[model samples]
Target: VLRNLAHNQRNHTSLIQAGAVEPLVAIMRNSWDAAPRINAAVAVACLVGHEEGNPRLQLDETLVDEILDVLDAACQGTMRHGSFWTVWKLCQGLASLTVNDKNKELITEKGGVNILNEVLHDSHYNNEAAHRYALSAIWNLAFNAASRLVILKTPGLVDSIRDIVHKSESIRTKEAAKGALWTLGLEQDVKSLSETMAQDAGWY
Candidate 1:
């Protein structure tokens, strides 16, 4: 109910005022069913997506971990697409939270980099939407130097971003990858890098 209503920006304020955050977090944490969890994630994303709701969402210290746990469970479960969408929305929400250093540190402490990198590496799923969302989330986290360093430490993350920037037809994905690499100080010359990657992939 709150999930559906939160789509409107005006209603986001109402929902937050109605104290939807705590119950939504609980849904993410306790819902054994995938559908409700996914919906709850979407609702949370929509709510926190509004500037006003960010502080309120951040008030729940356990929210980040709960969202990550939901993401993890979704990835491991049978509802692949649902989980992917859930991750996408969750990433959007988390991206907004990066303005706070504590939130950034909490995300990293809760293994966010590895989880997002794993999503990026899951080629078997052939999920470009998920990849783009994961990239956006990573890009958001990369805004912090410490988080950027943590991401760069992840094995093959830079390579993965490079591949996405060079090979992905989606400009959004390419741009997000570029932003992430730029933050990590990995995007030296995009033209040269793309050319090199294309040559290696025989696209040139």
Candidate 2:
């Protein structure tokens, strides 16, 4: 019953906005099954939405930790593809909520920054779908001024974004990287790097 409510395509994502995420996450904690857990993560991601600003949905207080835990669990196994997709969705949703100092601080405290950087740097993360979504998440995070500043101050984000941009074949992925480069470079004081991108991509 609960599973179907979550898994059914007919199930409206709008429910989460009505404040349904807490119970669903509660169910996930007891399911002990990967499929249901994955669904829960997806649902929370759905609740988060993909826009650049904060959405109309409201997450439960534990929402962030629950999503992070699910993502953390997903990364410790052979289900990298599935886990990545789930995390990708999760990031898209969370990105919208992380526009403030407190949320950005919470995300870093939860280890999100390091995990995302790892995904961007991983050799196996080159496929178009994976690369596109993962890079998009990275770009979104970089769009947050505080987060972008933190990322630039992280010691390797510039090189990481540069490597991903030049190495990736997916136009979506490259464009995502370009967006991040544009945001961080210009809005965050990396304009020299942005000019470099303009030169390379012939954007004159």
Candidate 3:
């Protein structure tokens, strides 16, 4: 019910005013069934996705942690399309809340960067859309110096991103990967590769 109501901005405002964050976080954290978890994640996303609502939602640190936990579990579990999309939405919601350095630090402290990196490396998923979302999450999280250092220091992260830029056929994936590398001061490497590929194709 709250999930449905969250689709409308006015209802979303009301739900937030009525203290919906705790119950939604509970459903996201405790629900055994995927359907409920997905719905709960979507509700949370709708609530935090708006600028007007982000301030209140950001005050609850546990809500962010629960969302990241659910997303990590879903990525490691069945990899069902619905589950993957729900997790993607959850990532999007986190990115939306990351309007400041403090929020980015909070997300990194909650293992958000590691979880997102894991999703990018999960070959079993093989879903381009999910990969794009994970890349976007990482990109958004790298908005601060501390978070950017975290991502750059992660083992094989730069290589993984390079592989995506060099190999991914999807333009969206390549663009997101490029954005991440650029954030980490690797734009020169990406440009060099682009030049190499262009020369190889005789486009130079």
Candidate 4:
């Protein structure tokens, strides 16, 4: 099953080489069943990045954009039969894709930041997983300067993330929320919180 494969990092290449990507995309785009759609998204997330420095998923620019588009559409509920779990899985895939630098830039250009921010405002799915992975996706996007500034400007987004940090019971979600806040709090400046502490300690 895709979920089992997702748990094992070693199977990533084997699955992709077997042409699992296209089918997975198809499921994410058109699966009438929410379970298949959600599983497909998680499988795609597992194939996302590796130590090779080239994304297993970002090999094609158009494919990357298409995935982002699916995610955006799914968030908006235009994609058929999408459930809260499906949206969460889609966010998980988006977060994983942001592991690649090029994907980060592409996602920003495709309005993925605004899309993720809207998840916080949408009342349709107050699902915890969706909120967590949305924060995680934004956390990854915050690594880029442009994305960070855009995130700051998005209405109520920063506050919504902070709310999650204080209220979420999931430690993973809280960590991601904190990570996004920390990254955005830099104000386009260099020095991280740890870096600032080290500098003050005269560690150089």
lDDT of 4 at 166: 58
Per-residue alpha-carbon lDDT of candidate 2 for residues 40-64, written as tens digits (9 for 90 to 100): 6456444544433533333333545
- Local error of candidate 1 at residue 2 (angstroms): 3.8
Estimate TM-scores for all models: 0.69, 0.59, 0.70, 0.66
Per-model lDDT = 0.70, 0.56, 0.71, 0.70
Give the distance in Å from residue 22's predicted Cα in candidate 4 to where it truly belongs: 10
Tens-place lDDT per residue, model 1, 1-204, is 677686556887778888997898687667776567656756776677445335434423455666676666556543443444345555555555554556677888888888888777775243676787788778777877788889989998889988888788898888888887887777675666777877987986
**How many steric overlaps are in each model, in order?**
0, 0, 0, 0
Quality of model 4 by C-alpha lDDT: 0.70
How does residue 19 of candidate 4 score in lDDT? 88
Regions of model 4 farther than 4 Å from truth: 1-42, 48-52, 59-61, 80-85, 123-126, 186-204
- Report lDDT (Cα) of residue 48, candidate 2: 42
Report the Cα lDDT for candidate 3. 0.71
User: With candidate 2 superimposed using the best TM-score fit, by how many Å does residue 37's alpha carbon deviate from the native?
Assistant: 7.5
Q: What is the C-alpha RMSD of each candidate to the true structure, in Å?
A: 5.3, 5.8, 5.6, 6.9
In candidate 2, list every pair of residues with a backbone clash.
Answer: none
